[model samples]
Target: MTPPNTGRRSEASRRAVLTAALDLLQEVEYAKISIEGLASRAGVGKQTIYRWWPSKGAVIFDAFLMLSEGAEGGPVQLPDTGDLAADLTEVLRATVTELNEPRYEQPMRALATEIAHDPELAAIYAERLDGPLREAKRQRLRRAQRAGQLAEDLDLDVAVDLIWGPLFQRWLHRSGPLTTEYADRLVATALDGLRPRR
Candidate 1:
């Protein structure tokens, strides 16, 4: 049985490990990060890292979670100004900007690469990272539903996916630049289909 103080120290060490992982990911590609290197950068023993995480991918997952602060793009709450188009436009535009930020880009790429290779990590990433953002968007859609701004038959879950899909695709594939104008167009297209006609 570990002492109560042991839990605190463990949490602190975990935080340090995550911080170091993020730093390393920024400095070097994901393929090069190692548990031993993470331990050194975190100022923790290698044994400590092994005691918690099984692989560097797991460390990257935790690091992404920490960097996202349990939410995507900053705050978790979606704006509900009663104007669904405007609110979604603002949110997606901000997401575009956040995805492009240098500090966030590396971890985002690392997480994506990790998920591609590891199914378990993919699940964890969805639970910790994608789920919260999806839920927030769902809640906002529900608000629009309540306001009768959106069609009663509008599938909230799919709608959320639809709104986010293009943004994620662009960011993940680097197919094109994400911009406020792109977000605005996406909002217009999505809302035109979902919103109640005048």
Candidate 2:
């Protein structure tokens, strides 16, 4: 059936599709979800879904983005403080929390596992989920450097890698506990390393 053109019902149908997609994504692996399945679950026609979203991946990713959005429908973002260490600590601590939350953790793992083999899915994940957060951190670091909190000549790409690498490694390998304390420690170590030698 074609989705109703009325504004209220259209919004409702969109929410249903989004909610159903997220529900299925959390329950099943990424590769197992189909647009037909989502439409059935959402109680909308496949044509309606196609009209709104380009593909199953787009719908699933949109659902994931919605599920992970911060307050006011924004992505999880880094905060800028004059103190670089404090800002990093705040951001990484929140990251630890999200990584520890099962609702997000499981879905993230499912996406990561599949995207490794599918470049299209990987690109979507990179652009939608990871890109904004990385850019925010880069902007924050640049601001800090200008404020004299970091070495003027620091390489931002390496600095970002240093800041986020270990955390992602641990998250990927499950080699150690991901805790706020660890996040704080990571920030302190990076800050110490970034300081110019006296």
**For every candidate structure, what is the RMSD over all alpha carbons to the true structure, in angstroms?**
3.1, 3.7
lDDT of 2 by residue, 1-198 (tens): 554568778888998999997788778866788888999999999999999987666676676767766643655556764666777888889879988987787666666665666688789777866787678778888888888888899998899999999998899799999999999999898888756768
Q: Cα miss at 166, model 2 (Å)?
A: 2.4
The whole-model lDDT of each prediction reads 0.86, 0.80
Query: What's the true lDDT of residue 41 in model 1?
Result: 96
Runs in model 1 deviating more than 4 A are 4-8, 70-75, 193-198
Q: Give the TM-score of each candidate.
A: 0.86, 0.78
Candidate 1's displacement at residue 169, Å, is 0.9
What lDDT does candidate 1 reach at residue 56?
Answer: 80
lDDT tens digits by residue: candidate 1, 50-125: 9898888888887877886655456578888888888888888888999999999999888888898999988887
